[model samples]
Target: MSYKSHTVLLIPGIFDRGSSLLRMQRALAEEGFDAHYIHLRYNSGWHGMEHLSSQLMAKIEKLVKKETTCTLVGFSMGGIVARYYLQAMSGINRVHKFISIASPHYGSYWAHFLPYKGGKQLRVGSEFLRGLNQSVRVLEATEPVSIWTKYDVTIMPHSSAKLEIGTSYEVPVILHRLMPMSSKVISLLKKEVITGMG
Candidate 1:
């Protein structure tokens, strides 16, 4: 019954080496949770979403064999990756909860403006991105919690930060990257994790 025994998989956002979640992971560990980080490499390249989603699914499959249950803590694009994995892969059933911080559940305007070969792949208006958002909405309906931030700069048109059917929190002062380390964000995550376990 010790929730601390559950492992937390920390997925980092676009172009992030997973270093972004290090402080938060350590803090979670201090609170008696087992935390691990996944560094997604193709957040800015062609097929970035596909590549990361496949990698995350593989990791979840591997973890399912050893852990009874897990929680996914995804940041920004990482949240999209986690949602896709849960929806498309069967390994996600082993997960007990999901927590997203500053994630673009509905796609982001920044992707529409970025000048890159794969930039269009992230556009909120793109057919692919819109479809992915729909899938995430369905997943949120069945998951424990889906947290978001209102002051995110990366996911402009802040509405992109919302999920369909879960508790949504709006922290008014933190930016996108800073969310993973913000005290308020951490507290929210801690509360969600505890609630999920209970």
Candidate 2:
């Protein structure tokens, strides 16, 4: 596909008021690329990970048409949600590039306090995470990229942000929430977006 046809779909973290990723969306748009920030109906994920992913699939189906794929930019819980769409919802066949920022791919200690169904899934060693990890190779064709910070407190063991598959970048950003807005992170993301268009 041509670079002009490249579309980026950005998914925000859990419990978003729906504007958490506006800055990232604008950055992509300012770069002259087509980008959309997808808001989840159940952002708090009170239902569960599967339910959140189902919502993601529906939004993606509306945005991406047959024979055309888009790059996905997911932050925090949104990253895992996007992955469920890719790994389990057959989204891998439709998505070419996967970029996750400050996501807890390996589950997070912070989730221990979350009592919601979706929150429970984010806890360390949850069945949901283990299942996703087991089938992560499904994303090999997409050459996933994970961006994280060494100082993230939201995701305990900060190393949990690093993916076991594909490329991972550890930026010097100070916080997890800042990953999507940091200039350094955005610059690298721009490069990744442009490169995959080839």
Candidate 3:
């Protein structure tokens, strides 16, 4: 069977070893899309979002063909990693669609407990996020989409998942970490990736 031209790169969230995204990958495969996910080298993001983003860039460079664009589906902090690549690493030009699921685009209160460069950057008013928020318009080149749940405890004020530059969908999923594996979220992804709907 012929697969879709654009690849769907699944970037797992913090603490995700890889299995978190298997269901999504399987769904995409069954739908005839090219899907791939690698366990991030800096899964904890201790080094910083840029470091994690660089790793994503390298994988993209190796996996995607020059003729093909990619669709990025980042879960939680994985979303921030993808944004760093898009806004700072010039990844917007290479993407056809950008999707962030349960990501803290506005920073998370829960980040206060995690004392690390990556966690600090995820705080409510970090310079890293400030810089990215200012230029979120860049993602407009690709059809940017945000998926979040109202019950997300990890984001502490789940509205943080609503981005300033994209269409936001509120799924009824209960937990933040389970978003990528939720059938509702997966179905939403399929719709967004295929239709780019508003």
Candidate 4:
């Protein structure tokens, strides 16, 4: 269970690219950790979760061949996707730690308000999110750490961003979009990473 040399898979939020997580990936690399970014395509009308999850699982399978343990760094919707991957996929044994930043562990209120052509079908936090949360809660409780932010606007009601069990970190001032690059947030994350790895 010594986690010092484990590979970290960084997953980005919704409507985002791998470049969004580049800074953090570089930071982790600088710390002498193996970091990989999962780039998912948005605007596939939200039906891309299966495809994206499959891609992630494939990458993880490859990593498992080399390492005994891995860590997942998921932000926002990417956290949800990570949860789904852990719950539904059979290849999650390689993941030793899971850290979520500003993710909607519960359903988000803003998702109900956003106007999309496909509406609830095209976004998270609808009935799908509610069910996803229930499932995630069961799976996440087995993980080592689950981090959250308090001042997130993207996931309204703020409470939606909390984890029901496991060690949760609540940062007071950072917003959702800035969570990836904030120095304070990165510092907090490094601490959690060390804690989880231990």
Compared with the true structure, all predictions reach lDDT values of: 0.73, 0.86, 0.87, 0.68
Query: What's the lDDT for residue 104 in model 2?
Result: 89
For model 1, the local distance difference test gives 0.73
TM-score of each: 0.87, 0.95, 0.94, 0.82
Candidate 1 lDDT tens digits, 1-198: 312236788998888888878888988888788788986667663575667888887776676455466788888888877777777665455677888887777677898676664466666776656776566544653364556666677887687777766778878656777888888888888888767676
lDDT of 4 at 184: 66
Cand. 2 TM to true fold: 0.95
Count clashes in each candidate, considering only residues at least 3 apart in sequence or on different chains. 0, 0, 0, 0
Error of 4 at 140 (Å): 5.0
179, model 1: CA deviation in Å?
0.7
Candidate 3, 56-172: lDDT as tens digits? 999888988876678899999999999999999988767878999999898999998889999999998889999999998999977789999999999967889988776889999
Per residue, candidate 4 scores C-alpha lDDT tens digits across 1-198 of 423345888888777776768888878888767889876755232564556677778878776554476788888777767776777775456676787788776757766664653235324446656666566555553364555666777876677777776677777655788878877667766776666576
The residue pairs found clashing in candidate 4 are none
Sort order, lDDT high to low: 3, 2, 1, 4
Residue pairs in clash, model 1:
none
78, model 1: CA deviation in Å? 0.1
